[model samples]
Target: MSNPSSKPIGLEIDLLETQGGKVPLEYFHKLISQLQKNHSLDHLSASPASAGEFDVVYIILSKGTLYEETETNAYECIIIDGWSCWPAGFAYLLVPPNRRREKANISGGDNGPSDTADIKIALLPIAQTRGFGRFVIRTLLSHAFDALGIRRVTASILCPIQPSHSVAQKKQVGFNTKQLCWIFEKFGFKFEGISRGALMSMSVVEGEEPVWHDVHRMSMLITDYFQEKRSLSLSAMRSFSREFPLKVVQQSPWEIMIQRQEKEKHDVESWSKRPNDASANDACGNDGEASDDETVLGGDEISEK
Candidate 1:
């Protein structure tokens, strides 16, 4: 079932700039000026077909100035100024999937980039729960399959352990490997295998030696993405249209996490105060496992330019 609106997602960078969200006038000017000054689009030359440590320099901004009209459109101020504003967040696409290159420039034909995988992601702490992660990745899928003509996208992630926190003090982006993997799952990614000690610790305390955590890897094909999107749209319509007031329940895609968290917290508090009867125990079977999982990080990746 396709969306009621018959528009196939148009996701070119130029079009994304206008419709996604408002990039500050100054920021937009600065980004274009910098790209012009540095001719940074050359970074796109890393054909997925060419492997074994290629270099590409990228510009990233620390300060995120993203605006919104509707919730699903994920526009960014993508600093690309080659810097980080907050110590914890910013998003960058590391060595994008392979491109269909011309024969004169062809090296490995189809094998080199066919299975290309490095896609690292992170976001500002404030931005994580707002559904920016899903929006950005969704846009990326469109760009990868439609614009670049990539057949598939593979991601190797260092997923973090899950967390539990009180309502007031919640953990923002870091060790959110699981959160990232979860979103990827919805958008047609499958869990592969975990690599032991594949990632160093995310702690910053003194006298803390680096602890090893496993890395999680996943991949998705363009065909799967189309199927997933169709299913999700149909599910949304069916799930909400019958029971809930469709007009009143309208929300940005990102608010799902926020609303769910509020519901979970209310449930936990309600149960915690309830009488310690078998009925209550049966009803509250480890509801503590449900916590905020909207936060994920996209760490920096260095490649040969």
Candidate 2:
């Protein structure tokens, strides 16, 4: 079976209420079936639509109150669809900024941005990997950084085990294993230090990552070395004349033969003048003759003493 989460597709985020007052029970049943096929939903308490039936019942769930203390709160729900391998699912959750802070450890410190807003995302188990999580994060960042002019925002991943750390790493989001510190370093979150299990951020702002100038400089040096080596090799092979007037005249055939005859005559004279001793005999034993197999200089006939 194809993993629906692996499919590459854009997510469409819309308010849950836009569909109608209550979605048909059949839609919920289809969604539950899809989730059952793709993921483990044993923790959820979904009931059959009717007695002795397997179909799921449709229900409208309230998220959070719009107002604080008096039960007025803004309710946010997500309806995700268009996944090729799985049916659609709905996730409804309350996103009361103040109320959420009271119950959860939302970052609202002096180091944290004062104007930033808190947004919570709830997803059905099957819809977690179908680009829904990324879409929600991008949306939150756009609103915090672009719309509200907020420098940074924070989020709390509610799952007992957050498996999307790799996904966050791909997006360059910074992680702090400390409490209330899921800081997106791309938007100015910084490593202040370690706290509990999360990282503390002293400041948050959008900035470029540090560039490695030394790496580029080293690459240029290597390139220059190769270029210089090539130039030296080429110059060694190229023909060039010296500027000085020193000349080497070629010896004529007669001049070369005369020099050879003089050398042989001197050798014979030295051998004859030697004392009749064993050492002298040994020295002249080989004779002043070039072997027949020896190479003669510029002549076809051997010289006769």
Q: Stretches of candidate 2 above 4 Å error?
A: 1-10, 16-113, 158-305
Q: Global lDDT for candidate 1?
A: 0.48
Residues 203-253 of candidate 2: C-alpha lDDT, one tens digit per residue = 223583322110000011223333544564565545233334458999999
lDDT of 2: 0.37
Please, what is the whole-model Cα lDDT of each candidate in the order they appear? 0.48, 0.37
Return the TM-score for candidate 1, rounded to 2 decimals.
Answer: 0.42
Candidate 1: residue 32 Cα off by (Å):
19
Q: What lDDT does candidate 1 reach at residue 15?
A: 16
Q: lDDT (0-100) at residue 49 of candidate 2?
A: 24
For candidate 1, write residues 177-249 as lDDT tens digits: 5666787787789888777767665432678666555667788887887788789788877867776764766
